[model samples]
Each structure stands twice: as structure tokens, then as C-alpha cells.
Target: MSSDTSKFGEYGGQYVPEALMPAIEELDDAYRRYVLENEDGFVDEFRERLRDFGGRPTPLQRADRLSERYDTDLFLKREDLLHGGAHKLNNALGQVLLAKYMGKERIVAETGAGQHGTATAMAAAHLDVPCEIYMGERDINRQRPNVFRMRLNGAAVNPVTTGRGTLKEAISETMRDWATTVETTHYVIGSVVGPHPFPTMVREFQSVISEEARRQFDDQVGGLPDSVVACAGGGSNTMGAFSRFVSDESVDLYAVEAGGSSLAVDEEEGVAPNSASLSTGTEGVLHGARTKLLQDRDGQIVESHSVSSGLDYAGVGPELAYLVDEGRVTPVTVDDDAALEGFHRLSQTEGIIPALETAHAVAWLEQATSEQLGDSVVVCVSGRGDKDLESVIEETASREIPNAPDMDVFSGGMR
Candidate 1:
């Protein structure tokens, strides 16, 4: 698609520096040919690799305990079961493969929770390509396990210390790296938030979640679900879960965002206590796209906070902003405490440990009204909680998380 057609209404556009135009243009062409048109059996190969390597068709199982609690038929789209233990692999593998086909010899990317970094590293290793990942220093410390996983998979993990040491800075640093090394490197953006082909391309790659869930729901549940909910940070999995259901007017799509501590913004301090951009953000340009952002009155980007490092972002994906504007998707929020409760609740009841990011969606289910959910709902379990164990323990201990397990035994720390 052309730059104009790339947009979801006016929420998307190429707003990058002039130096990155050639790389963006080239990637757009490759996206059209390989991804859109499936040139050289690319789509076929991608699917084959996904099945044999990355593990396609993750289960869409009914959450019996959660359903009983919510008084609705609740199903979980178990993306956590996929290789790399999250939905990140779907896009990472696809982008890395695309880069290989485009004859790029190196891969670069940004990560917040480290799921994407780990996934990218695994894909690059499998494809025999050199890879590097830029991560915020704070996130690197919080997500040390994932950092180790990436290095184990043979990718360099570069820490970005600028700004709040979070997703925004990592993305900015990656863009700078890509701008300088555009000819030899492909920047595998982890989410559907960047310029032109990236938002569209990442969504298409990750849409397998809903594609399979939709089919499986029909087969198992006998009809369409009443609502489809997923956590929205930069909106890869959000768009993925909602894309296939967008045309289905009967299906309600809910994008649950992080409501860190409060929705209030300290404009003078340039900090927002939440990442609920979809719910409260105004329009602005950020990270090469025009979308909803947590910007001050003077248009300065504000810092965003979230207990889950993955969900802390100043802006959301352009398409998600457009969809919310069009009223096709409803934007919602769940506070950090509720999310922590959800993290423990699911683990106790459903025998599944969800990532703190996924916990946001789970928490919303508890807060949502019966009328909002209808009779059947599907929540995307975006990732497993293995990466968030340390953060969860610390946060759970700091607050009185109702569903949290006994912590007195490990009061010192998990050795």
C-alpha cells in the first residue's frame, strides 16, 4: 500500500527523518511483495516454519474456573503455549524471515518485557543471522531472565539508558541504529506502532491468534464470541486479536491498557502515571507515526508508568487509536493492583501463570459488567508469566495482593 493507504484514517503516516526514507520505502516494497502477495512462496514457507519450528495453532481452550467466576463462558486464547512463550514469536519470526528474504545480513530490534527480544534472538539463531536487541536499562534489570535468554540465543542485548529506560527510549535508540545501518540491518520492531509497513506487517503476522481462535470458536463453542479482549501496549497482540473480528460487527473488541497508578498526568513533571493512551491520549506524532499519545498541552511527550514494563508506553499503535476513534473497539483500563490480583488469580484457579501484561486483560474481565461481556468472551493470554516472576514477587510483597500466594517463606527473595 502507498503511504496514504497505509493510514487507518489519519492515525498513521510516515513521520520519520529523511535519512530513513530509503529503508522504509524498501521494506514497504518487500512487505507488499512477500507478505501481501506471498512472492516466491514466502507465505507458504512462513507457515511451514511456524508449524514445525515456532509451533502454530496454539490452543483456544475454555477457562472453566474463570467462566464460573465471571458467570460467562470465558475462553483463553493460549498464545503463551506458542514457542518463545508469548505472542511475540509470531511477529519476530515473520519479520526476521522477511529480512532474510530481503537479503539483509543483520537484525536489530527493541524490547520492553524482553519477550520480543528473546523471540527475535531465537528466530535469528534459527535462521543463522546476526541479531542485536536494544532494551531499556530499567527493563533489562527487571527482565534479567529474558535478557539471559536472548544472549543464550546468540543475540547482543544493548541497554538504552536515556529517558526512563523503558520501551520508548529503546525504540528511539533502535530507530537511530537502523537509520545509521539501514543498508545492512533490518530493525524488527516488536509491536504494531512504527511507520508504514511495520504496523500493518506486524498485525498481519500476529493476526494468527484471532484467525485460529475464530475458527476454533466456531468449531468448539459453535458460534462467534460475544467479546474479544486483549492487552494493548503498543498493540501488536491487540490488533492481532481484533483484526479478524473487525468486520464482524456482532463481536465486541476490548483493548485493555495499563492504568499504572492513576490516569492523571503531571504535565510539569512530564510523567503520566498510566499507559492508557487509547482512553485518554490526544493526537500527536510519536516514533514515526501520528497516533494517540500521552503528550502535554504544549505537545511534549510525557513519561508513562506501569508495573508491567511491557505495557509502559507514551503512545499506542496508530491503528488501535483509529479503531477506538471509529468506535469499532472499546478502550479500557485496569489498575496495577487489580492486574497483580489477576496474575495470582489465574495461576491459582486456572493453573496458568500469565504475564503481567496479560494480567491486565484478566483483571478487566473481573471489573467488566455482565452486559459488557455478554454470554461468551475470549481473552488473549498474550504470554506466560515466567519472565515476570521476579517483578510479580516484589510487587506482590509490596502490596496486599488478595490472590497472591504465601510470601513469608521467601521474604528474603526467590533463591
Candidate 2:
């Protein structure tokens, strides 16, 4: 751990309201003891559960077709193959288990893309704990499959209708609930954002991505890749893919952000056409942490757009913001069109359907120069696309994506 513990350079700290202080303090202590010190074999049990339940040691497979197409050695960290079809299970299971250890009776979480909510629902069910999820109403409509999955796992799904009906509003609602019910409920933050202990604790759990990748890369390919790429929203997967590789000066990390329709913002309307916070955001305090955010000149958070619901966040993880500022992680953007193309490209060529969020990272391959990518590269495929089929069909039909297949065949429905 760093000397400061609660912060990543100048970015992370507990900036919550007074009502949430006790919960934060308790969580901070629990994180230090169970997570950091591994009290009562907590770490051992967590690993065993991950192996037996959540499916750890996800594959690091070489992408032969992608490599041949790009004339480079390309690899994929297959987090999409995890039990819940996303890297979200890594942190979700860990946090839920921690809550059990802390004697919490219920779990509450906020989700945008719904992967995190599904993972939390699964974990809560597996652990025999009650769970409730707060999600933006718009996202619920966009990701109905995931909503059904959460309900099937015996979790209640609450719709947050405030503030554009998206992640920011959902988080605010969850936090409000937590503030009132902190004694019996634990909040499972979906990503590497939020106040103290959450950013650090979530990273420690999610770091298993890079931990396995770094070892697998050395054993299979004999050295670090020249570059590692992963999509960044709230940046759990981005930090997961880059955490273990950060100390290696020779390895370059790229954080692909959703560029939406454009990078320009309508300050008067308080809307940013892109979710490229790490690329175009200025420093601001949001969601209890200091980080780069898509904000208007008056310091109000602006609405962000993304074809992928998962990447529609207005701010990024503080650690990722610090890393970008330190020049350890490069921030890049992929427009919705390129991301759609990459989604189809991977499905057609590699026989893999990536989540639209992961497609942002895939799109970067096409946008980056060969020299920029280097000869050896690794891309983290964060989630599967099953939950995105409806959105993809709709969005692809509206855009002139040259690689998109005919969607008319699905007129009878995806069944």
C-alpha cells in the first residue's frame, strides 16, 4: 500500500457527507484488516470462492486473426468468460463476501450497464443474502436481459428516474439509501470510484485480472506486451488490467473511452457528447472523490453520452485519473461508429461477441497507428455482448456502419 493509503497521489479521498462517515470508517478498518492483513484467512477463502464460484484465472489467449490482420502479436485477457460474463464478478463477489464477514444483512448497489448488478445479485444469492439494485430507468430498458437475470437471482431491481435516468443518478439514490440504512445494509460500489477504501479495496479485488495476465504473458509469450488496452468508464476493468503492469516502465497502458457522437460539449445545455472524461475532463469532485469529470464551466457535472450504457459515466476512477496525469496510462477515445464496427469485426473474425464497452478498446486498434500500438499488445475483453444484442441491433440500423451485417433477419426477434 502507498504511504497515504486512502489516496492515489492527489486524486482519491473520503469526501462524503457526515451521515456516511461511520460506514466509511468501518469499511476502511475492515478493508485494512480483512483485505490488507488477510485476517482469519479471508484472502484464502476469497480465492477459494473465486475459483469454485466466480471462476478465476480467466484465459489470456492470443488472437491469431487479430494479430494477422494487424500484423502484430495481439492477445486478449478473457474476462468476458468469467461466470457472470464480465469482469464485474471479481469485485462484486469479493465485496459481497466482505459484507457477510462484517455481519451485514443486506446489500444495495447502483449499476448503469447492469453487469455489476447481475454479478452482485449472483453473489448475494450464492451467499444467501438479500440484495437490492438501483439502476437508471433508461438503462433498465436498454439492458432488459441483465435486469431479468438480477430478478431471477432473487434481487429486487429499483428504477432511478432522476437526472437523465443514468449511472450518476442511480449512484446518488443508492448513496442516499445507504446513508439511511447503513447499519444493516452494505453498498457494493460497481467500479473503482467513490470514497476511501472503495477505490483501493475494489482495485485490490479486481487486480486479479492483471495478476493473472502478467504471469500468463511471461510464461506464454516470454515478456511483457508493448502495450495493454482496456476500456475505461468508472475504470474498474481499466485499473484491473493495468494495476500489476503499472510498475513496469517498459509496458504502456491505454485507456479507451467512449467518444460518443462527438467530443464537443454543449456547456449551456450541460451535455457532453462523449464519455471521454479522462481525455477531455477537468478536475472536479464528484461521487465523493476528486477526479477528472465532464463538467461545465460552473463546475456542474454535465450529462455524458455513449452508445454503450456501461461507458456513459461522467467521471472516472481517481486512480486512473492520477495515472493518466502521471503519464503511466494513455487516454484515448473511440467514437460510437468505430466501436460498432469493432463489435462486428470481433464477432465475425474472432467468433467472440464483445460488450459494447469492450468494443471501445477494440476500436482503438483500428484508430491507433501500428507504431503507437507496438508489435505486442494485450486487450482486455471485459464483458460478453449478450446483454447488448438489442442495443446493437437498434444502433447499427441507425448508423452507416460499413461492417454491420443485415439486421432484417432478426425482425422475427433474436430468438
Candidate 3:
């Protein structure tokens, strides 16, 4: 609402091309007038969509089995149940509505893992706006199901082959496109990782997650949880799940990073090996935000690798960076193997299949002993796993821990 909300502890600000200044300033003004001021029923219409369309007040379910296994009480905030299959829809729908208020007819977004892309496309379709999504060529190949979903919603998905063909390059490309189409287009950033207004804007929309979870948790548990955990990749869901609890001194907050592999400090330069940006990064600027980043000695951003594409970003949200620096948030990591195990365990035990991105939080929660975390913990089950069947299949086949019985040759499985 006010410009004071921008620049989280000296982390977020307008750092972009001169051409983008007007657009950023305009959107900032609109955010204040429409969202902060609630001008002309804008907030009313947005809240209605969240309730009727995006499925607000998502459930907070108790994970009894997981709790018992880890000797602690575990609860899940099910944002996965939201429309478009993940927490991305919260921001996507909000931005689409704001774009309408701004008189922008077209939308462009950058996505990794395609959850944000699908959410953007879905919101655009519902609002009858033209939409285009930028994705890396590699992401298009691995995340084909989501790419198809975007096309089905009438969104044009552009593939970038530059610079490892991942989210970083896709962001670079999307920013360039937005610079040219600033008059008629609004750039819908997928997460809470962009410049000043964006990190603040997206977080506000997603804050609904924590707001709902807080009330629900209080109703169910009669007290604040011992800790709240969420995976951090660009940090929208984490910010959503943790923002409300920052002042609750008794509640510990955890942001689990993509533990791709060994926690070696510099296993891979430019990339946070195992995708642990906070654990293996120096402070630098990337993608128009000043925050914790992974770069080489020469200060070039490197490519990050993780089984979950969403976590493979070189930089993290400025708010999260500030939180980490201030010691208000603790950063941990879970590798790909642990994440997949959590995926399999939850699907088998709770009948819930979490997205690879979300599984990281689940994995960390399951691994933390009762003493490590308190008797009760809440995890942000950020998204569903329908988009990850292919990757999971490929990973499980190579894993040797739990043997699968051989199936009949003709039949796909044992009769």
C-alpha cells in the first residue's frame, strides 16, 4: 500500500533497465492504489476469486503417520489443493487481476519447473487475457506435461536455448521481452524473487497461506507450532508460510533448500551444489534483485542443478536473504534422494503425492528427529506431484534401496 513496504531490510529495490522504470513505477503506484487503498472494489474482486476460483482456506491436515514415524506431531498446509496444482496460482491470479486494473491486455512470465507457468496460463485463460511464457529448452523437454498444460490453456510457451536453458536464462529473456512490450503487457513474476515491488507484491498475495494456516493451526493445536518448514526456491511459498510467524518468538522457522548433492562449499561454482543457495552462496545481484547468490570467483552466475527444477535457481528472494542474514530464519537442505523418498513415503502413507519442490520440505520434516525439531512441526506441502511422474519413475528405477518385484513381460506389471 505504501512505498515503505518496499526494500525488505535493504534487500529489495528497483534494479532494472531505464526503459522498465516507468512500468515498475506505474505498477508500484497501482499496487498502492488498488491493493493498499482498495480502490473501486479491486480488493473485493480479488478476494472473491481467491475464495471461489483459487480455493482459499486450503486445509491444514495432520500427518499422523509421518508424525509417529519421526516421533513428533506433523501437520501439512495443503496449498497443493489450490487451483492450478500449486501455490503459484495465488500469485498468478492476483497479478492477472491487477493487470486488468492497470489496463494491460497481455501477460508474460518466466517459469522454472513450469508450475508458475501453468498457473499464469490458467489465470490468463480465466481472465481472457493473452499470455506468453518463457521457459528454458531443457525445462520444456523434462517438464513436458506442464508445457502441454500451458498450450492447452492457449498460452504460447517460448523456449530459450541460451545459457544452459534454465530458469536464469528464461528470466533474462522474459525481462528483455517485457522491456519491449511494457505499454501493453505486464510481467507476472513466478515467485517472490524479483525487484522491489514484485517481492513485496507476490508475498502479499501468497501470505494468505500463512494467514490461513496460522488460524487453522491455532484452532487445531491450541498453540503455535514448534516450527514451520517450507522449501525455498525463489521463496514465494516459504515467505507465504513463514511471514506471519516471524514475530512469534516461540516458533522456529526453517527454509529448506534443494540439497542436490554433497554440501561441499564449491562443488560447483555459479550453482549452489545440491541447489543450497543459502548454504553455498555469496552475496551478489542477479535477476534485478540484490540477494544471496551463487557465482564463481570472477562473479559470474553459474547454473544450479537439482532433480526439482524449481529449486535450481542461482539467486534467492531478497526477503529470504535478509531473513537469513538477520538470523530470523534458519536455512537447511535435503538432497534429491531424500526428497524422492519423502515423495514416495507420503504417497504411500498419506495418499498425498507432493511436487518435487514441495517434497523437499516434507523430506526435511520427516528426517528431523523430535529433539532436532520440537514435538510438533508444520510443513508447507506447496504443490501436487502430478507433473513429476516422469522424473520420479526414472529416479526410482535406478535406486536400489527397495527392490520392486519383476513384472510379467507382456503386461506392464504383475498380473
Candidate 4:
């Protein structure tokens, strides 16, 4: 896709009113100039900050036990080691710096899992900019740890009660806030699924993952990875890890989506839910751009449930939809049980507990091995599992176990 027409694949043109176009155009122009001229320095500065401030080049460890269990080569890109514990900091650092360069006073963002909110708060604190994070009431409750982290970082967290009180509702609130205060407040979108300059801009900032992964894999294994996999909520981490390999058609790109319960047999129906939008969704306009959405015939967005809070979104980014359509990317869905299982498996085997969101990618290893994927598969472990301990324990306690024949038999006693 050329730069001029890259705004929308087939579905994502500027559908906003005339007033908003100029603002969007201005952002696009400024971003284009920044990318063309100053990106080299911006990237270098960001890397230094990530190394000294945020921690860069997190180890790409080979998952020996996981590889043996799955019978395939599996390597983990340890993004969970980054400061703030996810890929959110990459974009937050870039955008916050850009906001500083533009002389913006306040920064505002919307977050679902609160990872992005916390990261943004950290950046704003570093830059001494006023920051506000809008989150849905439900999400705030579910992701309280991150909310508190953001508050400790000095960001005021506002709860959105309108609509479904989820990420979508939070997005609506953020958009309204941005429209009213666009001049002094820079809205930092958390993912790659937003407006034009946003999708492109966020992707550029996140491309650092693939850039480093390319060199790291070469140093470790002496060549590019055979496959690169990441969980896709709005696809920031996935896009980041896949950007440098975009032109490398020979390298495989796998995007894992939340597939709840459908993977386990003997489990009751609906025990797990599936939120695979690209596989089961249709083209539609959602959250400012045209993309694949899990919606009904009447155009109302359907309620999407996933074990991963981050991947619970109803719509995906335009570029991903384009890639899926062109067969450049493969989309797979894993159930909640599988993801939870994969989480425990990785934790026990590799001593690396991954976020529930990132576990969806690990779960894909099961399917990938079954399909005979090659020896080297790199999975993006986007965040640590610290946030999911409670849920994991709760789910484990709820499982059913069969009764043993007799305890006396094990004790060598007569019954």
C-alpha cells in the first residue's frame, strides 16, 4: 500500500466531518515530517531511554521444556521485562516525547487493561505533564492493580459509566474528551486500531520490537526466526514484532486471538468462549475506522468475552484486516482454558509467567506444532503474569477432579 492511500485498506477512509479532516491532516503532515527527518534520532533516543530508563533488548530466551513438550522450536521475546511490564511503554515514550516536542501541556489516554494507562502515567510523570486516563467502570474493577499503579504515577483515573462500561465505552469518553480539548491535550491512543495518523504513527513507534528482535534472533540463532507470533488485541505488539519482517514474505507471521473453551473436549459447551474477530467477523466501521468487527446483522456490536482482558475487543486494526485478507498473516484463536493452561505451562517450564493476554500466543504453539511449523518460532511475551495470579488461582480451584479409588491403598492399609 502506498503512503497516500494507506489511511484505509478498503474499509478505513476518513469518514469524519469536514472540521475533523483538517486536524487529522495536520497531524498526518507533522507526523510525516517527523518520520522522514527526525525518526533516526527519535528511535535512538527512545532506545537509550528504554535501556537506561525503560530497559531495552529484553532477553529472547529459548523455551527448552516448552519446545520439547510441543515438539517444536519455541523462543520467547521477553517483552514482559520492559519497564511498566508490557509493550505499552514503547508507544507511550515515543508519543509523550512527541507531545513534549509539540509543547503540549496535558496528555490523555484510554486504556482497557490499564497497562497503557500506567505506562502513559509513567511517561507523563517523567516529562512532568498533567495526565488523565479514562477507563471503563468494569475494567477499573477488573484491572485494579494497574489503576493503582497509574494513580501512584500521578495520573488521575476517570471512570466511564456510560454505555457498556467497558473498553468501548472508555473509548467513547476519550474521543469526546479529545474533541473538546484537542488544542492543549494530546490524546495518546493505546493501540493500533484508532484513526489514520494514529494507526501509522503507533506502528512506527512500536516497530522497535521487530527491529531489535531481528538482530537478537540473528545473534542467538544465526538467522531470522522461522515464525513470529504475538497475541492481538488492537495489534500493537503483534504489529511491532512483525513490522520489520513485513517485506520478508518467507518469514511466517502468526497472530493469536482469544478462543475460549472450544479447544477442550469433555468440557461443557460454552465452558470456554471464542472471540476470534478476523475469523468470524465482517467488515464494518468501528472506533473511527473501517475494520473487521464482531457485530450482528443490525450493526450493533456484539458482546465479546475473552480470558485475556486485553484481547476482549470487538474490532481489530485495519492493517491486520488487510494482511489477513491478502494471506500475508495467519490468524488463530485459542480458548480460555488453553490460554490458561499455556500460562501455567510456560510458568512451570520456563520460569517465565506471561500475562493472560500473551498466553494466547503461547497456546498457538499447540496448533503450530500440529501443523508442522518449522524449528524456530518466536513468540512475543508481551507482559508478565503478575496481574493474573488471582484469576489463575480462582480458575484452578474451580476445576473438577475425579475421585481416587482409596487412600488406604496408597498407605498399604486394609480397607
TM-score against native, each model: 0.98, 0.98, 0.95, 0.90
**lDDT value for candidate 4?**
0.79
lDDT of 2: 0.95
What is candidate 4's lDDT per residue for 78-122, written digit by digit as tens? Answer: 899999999989999888877776677889999988888999999
lDDT per residue, candidate 1, 1-415, as tens digits? Answer: 4732789899888999898988999999999899989999899999999999988889999999999999999999999999999999999999999999999999999999999999999999999999999999999999999999999999999999999899999999999999999999999999999899789999999999999999999999788999999999999999999999999999999999999999999988999999999999999999999999999999999999999998999999999999999999999999999999999999999999999999999999989999899999999999999999989998988998877888777557667
Order candidates by lDDT, high to low.
2, 1, 3, 4
Q: Model 2: which ten-residue window has the lowest total lDDT?
A: 1-10
Question: What is candidate 2's lDDT per residue for 79-162, written digit by digit as tens?
Answer: 999999999999999999999989999999999999999999999999999999999999999999999999999999999999
Lowest lDDT sum, 10 consecutive residues, model 3, at: 401-410
Question: How close is each model in CA RMSD to the real structure?
Answer: 1.7, 1.9, 2.2, 5.4
Per-residue lDDT of 7-82 in model 3, one digit per residue for the tens? 7777777789999988988999998888878998888999899989888879999988888887777899999999
Q: Which stretches of candidate 4 lie over 4 Å from their true place?
A: 1-4, 17-19, 39-41, 261-273, 370-372, 400-415
Q: Residue 157 of model 3: what lDDT?
A: 100
Decide which is better by TM-score, 1 or 3: 1
lDDT of each: 0.94, 0.95, 0.88, 0.79
lDDT of 3 at 286: 83
